[model samples]
Target chain A: GSSRPMKQTKESPNVGDVMSRDVVTVFEDIPVEKAAKLIISGSFDHLPVVSRDGRLIGIITAWDISKAVASGKPSRIAEIMTRRVHSVRLDEPIELAARTLDTHSISALPVVDREHKVIGMITSNHLSRLLARRR
Target chain B: GSSRPMKQTKESPNVGDVMSRDVVTVFEDIPVEKAAKLIISGSFDHLPVVSRDGRLIGIITAWDISKAVASGKPSRIAEIMTRRVHSVRLDEPIELAARTLDTHSISALPVVDREHKVIGMITSNHLSRLLARRR
Candidate 1:
């Protein structure tokens, strides 16, 4: 006897299931130059900023880093980090994240919880994994 | 002004010229699961594995993370991360790096120095920047 498929009213993958729950983060207090260095050395497109206790704050990206580098100085990361963050809930539909990335031409989204604390992140590359494995 | 017309000499764009001199990295000591979380949360395609002294050891990717998760505890990240790292020096021609990425179907390459320490990284996205800006 094989017990397998479970019936469900609707089917969808959620951010909690596929989203990367652990995110690379930078302290909001980190120097702008350090943040830029992380983006360059890590090859990460973007990074989330958080409080000491892991509360979500904002995000910084390579473009922002580049700007800081080009500006040369007198620019702090706090001033340049994106405050208008676009986030999704753990239970939100993956499609929501995809749409967010597509609409903004953003490559990633910070995943947050009820307290607005970032839990993970979702990127087009992660979404591509879903496509690569789905039969 | 003919001042810009300069003497004729062979010219080339080297990897160091455009490579992100900054790199995001993980210590080889980090937990494998934590590494996976980093991949997902950071929205990074690949992350360089470094030693305590910042020597380039290997690299882990989203796929590596997934496999580690799938294999469960019996697996160690050191075993899964790509050990046969294909690296390019900072001074290597960009063409060489591009060819390596294309040939291996890898998305990024760790830029190293003569000592084999990761100095930076080059990715398709960075290369895209050149095309996007060049007339």
Candidate 2:
């Protein structure tokens, strides 16, 4: 008699399982200086820029702040923030998130909902931790 | 009769295997502005600060530059760089690198030699790529 194949015990986690739920976001109207302070104080390198209705608009990073300092322009987040943001949904596979990050050369991605509101954030730091645990 | 156990086909790679060998370093005496330019022009967020004799002295990140811009002080790299930098050895395991990065809340570590000179650099980006491949 043939035996059934063993059920797989380990399944790949989704982005929601690894992402940080309590994301710190900044409004587009805020000064870049304030956003810089938030990034400096927090452990995160990127922050999602939100609209008045709490929708994801853009993303700001330490690099943007450095650029502002270097060029002495764009005092507001709306000016220096990267308008073309890449994001992932909660139910997406971790591999997809990893691929997106690697392809875009970005460190983090904001997790958005159906309404395009930022719900969480994931970064390479999270992937590093996951790899450490697996090892 | 007894049988020997099967040998493991896969082993964890070392820091040397994944690290970027061509590291970009900056001198300690250069202006923070110069370092900021290098960071902007390059794809790296951190730059190792080297002595005149090519010894690793400190490390500077985009966060440091943001701090300088926010505070409007410390124009030179020596003043703004983090003196207490954590590094890794080439022959060490990748898990150790991950743990060091996680423990210290740093994104990258400079790989050093027996003489404490920078030889390579590794970051979370590399680890992310590794994880992606394993999946």
Of the candidates shown, which would achieve the greatest TM-score relative to the real structure? 2
- lDDT of candidate model 1 versus the reference: 0.65
List model 2 lDDT by residue over B65-105, tens digit each.
87776676587899989999999999998889988888888
Q: Compared with the true structure, what per-residue lDDT tens digits does model 1 show for residues A33-124?
A: 56655664554566898888877788987555434333333345788788888888888876677677656656678998788788888765
Candidate 1, residues B1-135: lDDT per residue as tens digits?
223321211244778997887678887767665665565455455789988888888897754543332333323467777878899998787667766765675657999888788899877555434322321
Query: How far is A10's C-alpha from truth in model 1 (Å)?
Result: 7.5
Q: Pick the candidate with the highest lDDT.
A: 2
Give the poorly placed runs of model 1, Cα more than 4 Å off.
A1-11, A40-43, B1-135
DockQ metric for all predictions: 0.02, 0.38
Worst 10 residues of 2 chain B by lDDT: B1-10
lDDT, each prediction: 0.65, 0.84
